[model samples]
Target: MKRKLRSGITASLLAVTACMALHSPQSLAARDAQTILKETCQGCHTPEADNALSRISHQRKTPEGWLMSIARMQTMHGLQISDDDRRTLVKYLADTQGLAPSETDGVRYALERRLNTVEKFDDQTSQMCGRCHSGARVALQRRPAQEWERLVNFHLGQWPSLEYQALSRDRDWFDLARKEMVPLLAKRYPLDNPAWKKWQASAPKAQAFVGDWNFSGHLPGKGELAGVMSVTADGDDTFKVSVKGQYADGSPFNGDGSAILYTGYEWRGNVTIDGVTMRQVFAAQGSAMQGRMFEAEHDERGLDFVAAKQGSSRLLAVQPGYLKAGTETEVTLIGSGLSGKPNFGKGVEVLEVVEQSPDRIKLKLKAAANAQPGLRSVMVGSLKGPTLSVYSTIAEVKVVPAFSVARIGDGGGSTPKVQGRFDAEAWGKGADGKLYRIGVFPAQWKVEPFDDRAREDEDVKFAGTMQADSGVFTPGDAGPNPERKMSTNNAGNLKVIAAVDDSGKSLTGEGQMIVTVQRWNNPPIP
Candidate 1:
């Protein structure tokens, strides 16, 4: 029975490729996705004699998701494939068996790489699904009850000590998951869906959507961007794209590149933003588009990209959109439309309108002493600007990264330091009898040992020192001295402490910093 099932599955995959070959004959002849899959994936995925390719056949995922699976296989099963072949397989699988647009709606924030965006999950779901991995990971899949059951078994079979892990050991995890979580998952995300049915029925032509697209974006701590992207058909599945724009600082931001629109709506492109190579992950649904443009080398340093079929109007972005509570500063607002008097929301007041134009506006503003430490809406006539973040009283101080790992060996000179930032949050008891976040506030800096063992570590004294003004840590040279354990490098773990004593309130927070060995391959990606 299992042999028959595996044979049928292999035939189904081949049949799907055969249908695609009728339209993309060149694709089949050159780097055929299905050909790569048959050669590399069928061994373990397919049956020997009585085993089925159940897991492989029954699921779908994104291109990056498939790449992760391939990477996992290489790590665990020693699966080997050339880079070219890997790319071919990933592209093919994603094109033929990827999630529908509606299916990915819940996890779009994860794909867009938004920071600190929390996923909503019920108490049971949080405990059962979100405890080990992110909610997005769980939301990205569709499985039947039996498949979900097999997945639980696969977890136990692969990692026998799973139940003994800290989070899993709190209760009878296996029993609860079997009786409760499994049913919930099966009901919420079943294998069959109307969205997938519609998507698989017909493939949309990318040429129909090719045109000049107007876009706007913003990267926190960087600046805002407004641009135009001209897209033309390159092939049946590919496009040639060019972009031109400017940052808020007036620096030229432009690029020319190509893209592949897979899964109908996933527009994956390689382009340059502000002279830096970046990858564009856009979801094109009808005339509207939204996604991200991130450094291809390092996914961090990216911006939120949103575009529309029509020209931008009344869209405003305020640069450095925040002020120290009760302090005064100049604020710049950029957009395509402007008029009459401006309204600087509550807790803030405009002292003077420094400048005004259709595309720009500048104002000197002062924040009230009792200003709210959170985002506030900014409005000018009917045009709404990007919400501004305000900081005043610091009820709590926290090192941005709760913990970090920095390496030794800086190749002489003054030796590089890790520039850490501190954040003050308005933490207080709410009327609902719970502690809720009020937002970011202001703070000061210091350092100490994280624990008793850290206290004994001489690295705090001899290894490095933290700047009082800036939270940056300057480590001493790598060594083979008699100070540390085994006379190794000046490596140790310490705590970064941030303090805030403002407006008659005192608060403090600490984070762990691990100073360790040298990193040889400091690649651009890292």
Candidate 2:
């Protein structure tokens, strides 16, 4: 009776185990595959503890094959198992876990879901091909069946772990995968397309100039004269001019020049020549031809000319103090004798020339009552092909000053000096509310180069500093920390401080900064 009771308990326990196995969740069963392999077959095949069952699951074979593999494992690998228990486990695996027809269907369904279409390549082939190479690399090439076979053999040799050696055992499945991939790749990324054609078409065109221009013309022996002129245009009818030039000779012709023009049926432009000022006009002739030119103040000795073109590219007449705005009407005036001339005391001369539709001319002059009023005040003018002619009474012109400033010191020096130099003598207002002269000893200071080159010579060490009129200097932040104040280390070795005008006040501001320089060492000979 005691033995019978013990047998009953044993039978009950077996029934419970079977019930648990059948009722377990899919996730639990998946985990059980790993757990069973670990607990039962991990002794001799220690490295295969976790991977053994995974390898088996990826292989789809008949029930008999599964049993045979397990039998081999037991005999060859010394996995100890009773015949009855082994038979029961084999039956359980074959019935509940063997590859079913649904397994292939599920794999196909997953591949379709991931790729969004039916593909020539199976999921396994897609993964293997994409691992070390791009899909386009294979798709772009067309190959015969033999070529593809050779390609596969080459890959098998390159990456032996892909286990192409086992292909014989799974020849049918591998062949199916390969055949699917080849055609799918070929269709998606074809070799011929319009994008390639477009790229081939556009590769060469020159660029236009859109910046400042510096030009100069000088007389022979007398002090050399230089002039600066800038040209800019608006939509189709307006143009602006700023002319600043100087003569080395001490004459009445030296002074600042300026003009403004508007275009319509006729065009109008104003100009100041040597110390003489005048206005002129033009009418459009089918093609828009409008621009202005001024012979250098000392051009009487020789033809030193400066011309700017806009609206049209036609070359107008060449004459001293000639101003043309449009295409038809031209005005002539006299610069001297303003004292005897009506409204001449104001040093401005007005001349009425033939009026063409849309063209207007006006003149202005500034002179002293005691000044000599004769041929020096009269301006003679005429028109030639595209060029307006003007005769100036004043022959010699004075020089206009051009000045530039530079800073020199240690990158972070407490006291910084600005050295200024002028082509000619210059007297100008400084930010300090004091009058300053360029090139003179008292007004302009000479700066010597600093000796910080040892540390500041690096590309990263160069930097500049800025200061405000309030005497406060704020250094900017550097690096990723946007809110932190800029540091010396964060700045480059070299520094420059410049006086910048902001909000009507002259302030010191930081200029460009350099950080550290990167150098590469040569590689050793192999």
Candidate 3:
């Protein structure tokens, strides 16, 4: 049977090429049909064959059938023929390679043989069975024929959208596949298989959790708040905790940061909560534990926090600091300065010691009120000694004065230019310790117009002078001082030269007065 099948396949393949030569103009011109058949088709099909293709050919299919067969080969086997070549090849094959009744058996046998080899049982079986489940999962199941059939039927019916068409169109193929698959599964993945048994026995169990907690705390000027917490089991060792409560004034919490509860309770494994999934590791005492928390929803915003059980209660201590009058200072307070503790009001009493006289000290108390008074303070201090007592008190606040100018503009003169002066009292403290007063006058000057309109007039001339105290001069003697020039123009821009004193030295230093041209204004005001 095998020899006959192989021979039939060989003949059918030869006949295919023989038909191609008879029709193709390119091949027809150089080679006869027999030569094309011998070279291209004999490798796979022969004259003395019993293949599926030969059997179908023997039945005398219509022209359309021959065309379909040729089209299937071109599409499946990368037959690089143009459309016109395909039509020519198909016509020749139908005319010259038509099969007789006596050859029908050989053709049918060849086709069946080819079908068996081409319709892969392993690949199709694996793909179909693995659509909704693992291959190993299906293989591990040892079911009787009826049970297997029922399972296949259930899959086809249950997933009407997935397996219905395959089951209906290729019912025989599926049956044959199942027949081959069942025995292989029964032999290799029997119910008694150790690996299969182990997997079934060792599947992870559901998580579990325990206990409830409550917290009541004060939030400085924000007032009092309380929260309730409860833990529940997820699976074997995993647990989920739910927390809900409100602020002092009774506002409902919402969303993840609000009232939503968390589900991360993976004691021996991991759990996900409030979009924060975590792997949990327990401590020996079972009271303390640590793990990394991943932000499931916002993966980029993940953070880690430690959780511990004290007695029957759980405490979550985040970084602590004070938000006072727009100032955020992180200072730990001891003794009477502790805020939000029992008995203390919502404010702190700050004691300031001022110098009433050289010998006498004056005490001034500044009281800050809030929900929990003693907890927050400007300065938290501690006194170390025999008992090592700790305490915090308000520190004396210093006020630094800032300087401001009162006016600035042109001092009308022969130069008809820009000039202005600043208020001495507003200038504030200088390096001399005492409040210093300073003034500036036009020592030198020049002027430019508001627009390029004045640049057109080359004869227009303007000039003035300006003077300023040494206090207003920048600290360093860096030459390119921008403030030195009162105005600018294309007249190579104005230049200011400080006057020489009686000693024939430049008066550019210390408490000295120097004069230079300042600037000019056109069309002086009345």
Candidate 4:
């Protein structure tokens, strides 16, 4: 199995590829997809005893995973195929061998391009398999013990230095990987499962996502935003998408795009707004959808989004859910089937109804100076669980990501600079003296040396500059800078600071930021 999968390949040369978007399988297209896969993969992934492709049929993975497999074949092996046929093969294999929703629970971050995540796993899997890449790459697949063992041998063969690596040199890596890791992985992530069987028999159709959807999300640099996403059926398992929304700062966030659904629930969209193109990756389930919308060029800059279908009575979230005591402001509730009177709990009064629709409702609400200061549930008709916070003062301010990394690039180079985005999360002390979240608040941003080493190296002066209004830290150019003491380029360690004015005092929050170099080996799932 290892030889069949790794034929004519080096581990270092298995480059990543673009993700896949699939159409519903028809008899004719299905045959074509299978023929393409067989013609391209049969050379090395030869027929097995059961007449199945040896290595390919023994495992299951995500669409991104499947794409990576094919990409490795193209990059290392001598497989020659057209772009359309490759796309067809990917769609076919992913639809047939994709993991069920439950199996993908903790590993979706890999597919979402959230590369900054820190993963914690058991020692056996982490050191043996994921020392060179993300542990998520391992968790995103399902294989029997035989396949897992073969994969271990392939790693040893393709990368001859596997035994000389740090973790390998410390232990019997090959022996442990074959004997212990194989059984452990097979037991933990077996190829055949009840969930996959059920999903294959009754998967949701792409047409289920048609019509309008009310969504809410928090962009790292841009505060909270609420919007309406309109998805129209453009073809089989594809959509024409458009979104119109406003940030908490009143800036417009609108876009027009097209989307293609893969494996029923994987929704991928490419949208252009004011000429800038962005991509949206979402998972549609029931009457709700959740995902990320990111810049096509800078995938690191994106939003965490959640939305509800226009017909459901589900109350998703309250926009600007926090209100200052003694102030009246217009707040919007994002959801579906909104109706009846709006309730802001006690000590708060609904001044006037600004707008109303099945998707969203806007109202002028006032919180009295002596109002209860705490989290209160906001209910409307049958919608009963969303909360609103009334705060008299902010007790503390915390940066969203306590630690992050920013890369230097784009000095007329291919890789763009990865910005370190942040949001100032406010916390208020309620009457009970317990602290509760007051959502994201406006703040002034700056950077400073995090420690004596950073100060001595003048990291604050050389690493990057922070955007005052937007908590965005843009790193300096790629390559070494002659101005530095050691000519070490812009890479440095610094502290991100966000200062929020609360009542009469300034509340500050500090987070660590590491300015680093470009990521040259960016895989599809990394």
- The model with the greatest TM-score is 4
8, model 1: CA deviation in Å?
Answer: 33
Clashing pairs in 1: 424-441
Score candidate 4 by TM-score against the native: 0.91
The worst-scoring run of ten residues by lDDT in candidate 2 lies at 517-526
Candidate 1, residues 1-526, lDDT tens digits: the string is 9976564454344333322221121333355765665666787667444433547656677655665566557645777775556656666667767889988986876666543355688988887777666677767777788988988887788778889887689899899889888899899888788888798776566776688776678753345667678888888777788998887678778988778777788777778655677778789877667898777544445678877554444544666566667899887775555676777778799899999966567899999988756666778888776677666544455555576665555546223433333344445433344444544444566677777877876667755777665455666566475766777777778887777666666678787777776533221111
Q: Which digits, one per residue and each the tens of the lDDT, describe model 2 over residues 1-526?
A: 9876564454344332332222121221223334455667555435445344433433322233344456546433556654444434544454333322222232322211121122355455456564443332344233344445555765556455664434433454346546764445334332233432342243111111111222223332223333434445532223444555555443333333222211112223344655454232222223332222322211112312332222222222111222111112223221111122223222233444322111112333333333332212232232112212221121211112111222333234332222211112222333344433221111111111233652543322222233322211122222233322342333333233333222244433222222231111100000
Give the range where candidate 3 is weakest over 10 consecutive residues by summed lDDT: 397-406
Which candidate wins on lDDT?
4
Q: How accurate is candidate 4 locally (lDDT)?
A: 0.82
How many residue pairs clash in each candidate at the backbone level? 1, 45, 72, 0
Which stretch of 10 consecutive residues in model 1 shows the poorest summed lDDT? Answer: 16-25
lDDT of the structure predicted as candidate 3: 0.30
Ranking by lDDT: 4, 1, 2, 3
For candidate 4, give the lDDT of residue 344.
Answer: 86
Would you list the C-alpha lDDT of every candidate in the order shown? 0.66, 0.31, 0.30, 0.82
- Per-candidate alpha-carbon RMSD to the true structure: 9.0, 35.0, 36.4, 4.0
As for lDDT, the candidate ahead, 1 or 2, is 1
Candidate 3's clash total is: 72
Error of 4 at 362 (Å): 1.1
Q: Which parts of model 4 have CA positions greater than 4 angstroms off?
A: 1-17, 20-31, 49-51, 430-434
Instruction: Give a tens-digit lDDT track for model 3, residues 195-244.
Output: 32343344333321254333233321123334443556543332455545
